[model samples]
Target: MTQELKVINFMGIRKYTSGFSIILTILAVASIVFQGFKLGLDFTGGTQLEVQFDRPADLAKIREVLEEKQLHSPVAVTFGSDADVMIRTQDQMSIKGREYIAAEIARLGNGASLQDVIRPTREQEGFVDVLVINNLTPDQVAQSGLFDTTRFGKTIVATKDNTTQIAIEKGLDLVYSQHLLKELEVATGASIKLRSSDSVGPQIGDELRDSGGLGMLCAFALVFLYVAVQFQWKFSVGALVGLIHVTIVTLACFTFFQWDFDLNVLAAIIALIGYSINDTIVIFDRIRENFRKLRAVDPIEIVNISMTQTLGRSIMTHVTVFLVMAVLYVFGGELLAGFSKAMMIGVVFGCYSSIYIAANATVAMGISKEDLMPRPKDETEGGADLTP
Candidate 1:
């Protein structure tokens, strides 16, 4: 004879767990209200420049250089590797100033081309912001006596039409490459390259912040509608409660830790809503099934039985997801740190909300067998009736 499977009394303990859930909800709300998120460059609006060097860069020296140039509040930090650095500044440099800086970097490297330094923005006429290449060796360029300095002006100017002509006359090559910044590292022994650059305006940042919030609201609204249509209103309400709980708690963690809230983090929050709703719907479906099958059992007992039946599945699913998120958090690097951190937090809270918040909410809203049963058709309604 097989031993009987024991039904865990999950609903029986709801009284205690519900209180804990309420306390957690309150604390999460308080944290979010009191301490706001640490917004990232995507939502704060600033200039970011990524550079790579052949060798590890001296962060302090880089910072000092920016300071000397009067860049306001310039921040330089190591990226994935010591040779890779990302710099953020409140001020955006002018095209002429950028070209001058490129020249300075080329001098530091030994020799570099204009194409190896500044990023070009092509206009209908030609490349508007052209970098002038000093073909002279570092030593010759350093002498500052070979040519008329006044003719070159402060920055190198070149149009698409004259670029090849200028290169031929100057005994230099006019070309373009994504890794022009890397050439700087080769020329002067400083071995630096410009990887990428981005600049965001303050107004654009504000718009992004507002749009992110609106996107989250839209996601929740859609979730509520989907669940309500697929299941009963009570089930939809329970799932919505669970989703809200998970979102609030996740955001609260961000606020409490003062983590950078960016577009990636926003994406993670939307994903959390989907994950939490899926888990809630699974449990809700099981409850509805048990309600119909266990005719003699009380509604509370049926709920407990349903939770017990699905507990193993829930555990396995959450554990698998947690492992993947853990790997991402540990190895995805600083660029993906915010996304992985938010995902990890969401996974944990999503599991908790599905079990405690969603299930308990259904009970509080007075879910019963009748809620899942089909309503009787009205006798007066016109329909084909067949007697077999």
Candidate 2:
């Protein structure tokens, strides 16, 4: 004989779970208030250099060299492999020198050219002109002071239809990759190559940080309106409370671990809001349905029944999302680490809030069968009096 499935009484322990949720929310808020996030280059404005070496790089030596050069608090970390390293510096002081070094190494290799080693800057289109100077001596390339700033800042003229027009003036700080190379004999020594470089100015970084905050605020407002329209104001309040709980706890994870708060992490938090709201809506819908069907049942029993009915679906949904996030966290590397980690934490709390926070808050706010059902029309006044 098959054994019958038991109905779990989730609301039976609402007193305990609700108290636990309140304490957790307090701790999460306290953690966020006390420990601020460690903002990354995407928010703080910095230079990122992707470099590759012939062999595994000595991270300590790289850090020492960068420190000696007075680069701003440079952080060197390995990327996809041990041979590939990514360095982040608070300022863009030594980028030109690093590019010059890579150009020299490329010229020394047989039949190698500047384009073979040095990658162009992302802002190449902004340059007024580009010219290749291939046959300079090694000594000339080594002297960084020899680069003429006037050439970079000069105005270029173009003629068409017998009329002259001025092209955009180039910035004095623009570094051309083609002009940075020279000719030399190949040597047997190991060398590091510059794979890529990216920089964000401080002004842009501040704007991005502000925009991220605004985006989150907008999300909360939109969610509140949607829930209020779709259900009762009580349901909307529950959903908003649940969303706030998920957001604070997710942010608390970042603050407690001192993880990098970048664009990806911000995106993850927004996504968590959507995911958490979706789960809460499912339970709320079930609760509304039960209110109409079980008119004689107590509100607390209806809530427990609704939660129990959706328990299987909730477990399956969150577990699937959790597994995917776990894979991303483990294999997506440092680039996706912050995003996936935030998602993993959010998934756990998202489930918890849907059950304890959203459902419990709805009950506490006095949801009942009458809220979901329509009132009967008056039958006594159905017809007008003929005497009138």
Candidate 3:
């Protein structure tokens, strides 16, 4: 008598596991729909100011001070250390900049009149504001050396129709930054120094957001095509669903917890897709191999054997990656917090998804030995095999 083959029946709880996955997916989708995401400056477009205090900064007090100064809805967080703080605020028009530009144009003595200073809108980009001049052409204004002063950031001269518009770049820093620095200094009284300052326009932010989303979509499509070609369409369907599940659930964690969703986090999510699909492919390959070799075994038994064989490898890989990500989350500072957090979440779900979501999906799709077996050559059509 042949010795009996032994394997853990991972699919024995298929109904329970499938229900759990479905429930989690629903909850994730609901959280994302209702709560949305707390977008960061990289996506929403805003001014970011990093300041260092001589002493440890009081984050709450800093927020209060900002409120007192009428800078509502400002986000203040501790950056690298307690003494350093990063502040982000929405778009702000620079009144002082407009006034300075107007005076400079008048002093140019070119009979140029400052018609209007229009603040940048979402539709317009690469400029803080459009300075409509009545008399001077864009080239004339540019050559006047009015904006050549170091006080301004960068200037661009352009003409739309007959009107000359002088658009200034690197906005919100010339005026708003100075005012913010002064107010923060007086309020904190800790001798704060502005370490860095940057601004991103709404148009640029929109473009980044769109591009990030497009990148994710392309990743999913490519993954599907690859799996379909390498394995069967059934395995590809399972892999695609597994990827979508992992991505959505990870994003839902961010939305529910209100973490800063920025470019770094977006990159982490894309990276996670690759990692998750890799594990799925490994398990799928094993399943395909076992299905072809274990001809006498049942479909479920073959899957169980495949999973049991790869369990140790999967555990080792995921644990190693998880530990690295955990270290990154703890010590990588605020800059990499979002990235590491996203990665950690992905590792956990990526493993689970490969086992249950992807594998179980293939099983549910009625995968069989014949599905993964190599097709026999049509000897009858190939000249009767041409054998003796």
Candidate 4:
């Protein structure tokens, strides 16, 4: 049951579609400039704090408490999620702060319950630089058994009678005391202690940013060269044009949503270049074949017919890829959210540009009936370049 497919007569757009693309490119650039991006902690260093509670917690009051401690304007993210409280502050982590945290939660009656500190900026390089040397004022060890020593960070043991000692450096910055400690105990169902330093440096972020950008440029250039060699320069022009379209569209989506431009996004964009060029190649192959059959048609006519013939296939491929990307967007963890979003956007626009954009540029190269049509077998009147 091979049904005959009618060739869609698209009247076909003129070859000079580059002007339209220029407009789209302008929009993307404008978006990039006026609306900056919301960079993630991975690219920009910041502190992320996760605290759990037996009951719903109020962040406004918690921020107020931190404000009283000289740390104001903390970015809090808590919508009943595992990592509810994420604070991006300019202040650095330090020692002797654990006591202050514990005292404030109890004094303010804030039911923070449990707390875990993550210094994405510092921790990327190494742990904290500060240290905490606690010298407890006790005969030996304060086993009040009442102080719920398990809830406290730690108690110092002395060789002599009741005396005291204290020093501070940083490690973990985690404190187990008061309500915060109790909630931590209930949450983890285990005794916990704050030890070791957690810190991040700018060097790792800078290196990642540099490598990602460099890799994308190198990959794109290599792909452009390969396509140019495989097809004629005009066909390569189409493929490269489509690739640029996909890249800009994807990047614009990132900027619009304020998603961080990280290595994953960069990798996704590179993958898109390959995907877009592949579709362009499929159309170009069909156009070349049609040029042989329609010996008298303009190159633009062959391009249009080929696109019409391949439209169904293009739709099928992009739809399948889009479905998988949708799954990742919905079910994948936070780590993959950005990557999935980027892929989804690229695939959609990549297909559209492959047909409407890439082919248009090839036609715009002044392809005429003579240049587009396949040459006939050598004849007496044929050009000297052909053999008898």
User: Model 4 off-target regions past 4 Å?
Assistant: 1-4, 9-20, 46-169, 172-200, 368-388
Candidate 3, position 297, lDDT: 95
Question: Which candidate number has the best TM-score?
Answer: 3
Model 1, span 141-250: residue lDDT tens: 44644222332323333444322112111111111122233333443368676778777887998999899899889988898888788888898888888999999999
The C-alpha lDDT values of all candidates are 0.72, 0.74, 0.83, 0.60
Task: Work out the TM-score per prediction.
Answer: 0.70, 0.69, 0.72, 0.64
Q: Rank the candidates by lDDT, best first.
A: 3, 2, 1, 4
Cα lDDT of model 4 by residue, 266-314, tens digit: 7788888888788888887788778878887666667778888999999
Candidate 2 clashing pairs, residues 3+ apart or interchain: none
Of 2 and 4, the candidate ahead on lDDT is: 2
lDDT of 2 by residue, 278-377 (tens): 9999999998988999899899988888888899999999999999999999988666888999999999999999998998899899987878886687
Candidate 1 has an lDDT of 0.72
Model 1 stretches astray by more than 4 angstroms = 56-189, 377-388
**Most accurate candidate by lDDT:** 3
User: How far out, in Å, is residue 124 in model 3?
Assistant: 23
Query: What's the ranking of the predictions by TM-score, best on top?
Result: 3, 1, 2, 4
In candidate 1, position 245 carries an lDDT of: 90
Candidate 3: residue 83 lDDT (0-100): 96
Report, for all candidates in order, the number of backbone clashes. 13, 0, 0, 19
